[model samples]
Target: MDARITKAEAALLLPATTIPSRRLAEVEAIRLAAIAARDEAVADGVRRAGQAMLNAAEALVRALVTFPARIDTYRALRRLSDRELRDIGMTRFDIPRVFDPSFATRAANDSPQAPQRAA
Candidate 1:
């Protein structure tokens, strides 16, 4: 009753916050943009990873398809005389490793070879 509060002072004393609406909206916009960018980058990385997996799968499939031929070569080598096999720098035990596509190349290189045939 004495020194009564003004309408504006009463409004200021209410529970409502004083943060500017435009500033809040700008901050929210920046956070949303960052989230969207992160989502996009993750999606792109996933897509690339999927593509790499597909490529590896295709290569494995191709290797599987060629397995029979490798086996045939091994059989042919197995049937060869030891002398013949040795001439190619291989022993009977070497056939499987040699014909296997996944064999380490260094092992193959170090394996003995048949002498070069003259032209």
Candidate 2:
């Protein structure tokens, strides 16, 4: 019915043939299936990359915020008197060690005077 499809005026137009509907459907189905598969792969790739980027952004934000807080705490701790540090069960020399949990244990163990627990 389309105007672009010229009506056969001669026998050489393959005029007797009707395009098969079933084969057309089959080809269309295969093409659609291929497109769906490609879409799924692209979605999966975006999801994976998005997750990794999200994690990296979270880590960067934490590091940015945490470093400033830790530095501020270190400066504050440095300003404290030995008596004040002792009241908190820490020493002037233990400031850096206190910031690092791995070294905190060693520093605590090295201390001759542990905090006396009240009965």
lDDT of 2 by residue, 44-115 (tens): 999999999999999899888899888998999999998888777677777886667575556433565765
Best by TM-score: 1
TM-score for each prediction?
0.59, 0.45
How close to the true structure is residue 42 of candidate 2, measured as C-alpha lDDT? 100
lDDT of 1 at 115: 55
In TM-score terms, candidate 2 sits at 0.45
Which stretches of candidate 2 lie above 4 Å from their native place? 1-18, 72-119
Off by over 4 Å in 1: 1-22, 100-119
Q: All candidates' lDDT scores?
A: 0.78, 0.78
lDDT by residue for model 1 (1-119), tens: 67999999988897543655887778889999999999999999999999999999999998899989877887888899988877666777777777455654544225544455579
What does the lDDT read for residue 13 in candidate 2? Answer: 70
**Count: clashes, candidate 2:** 0
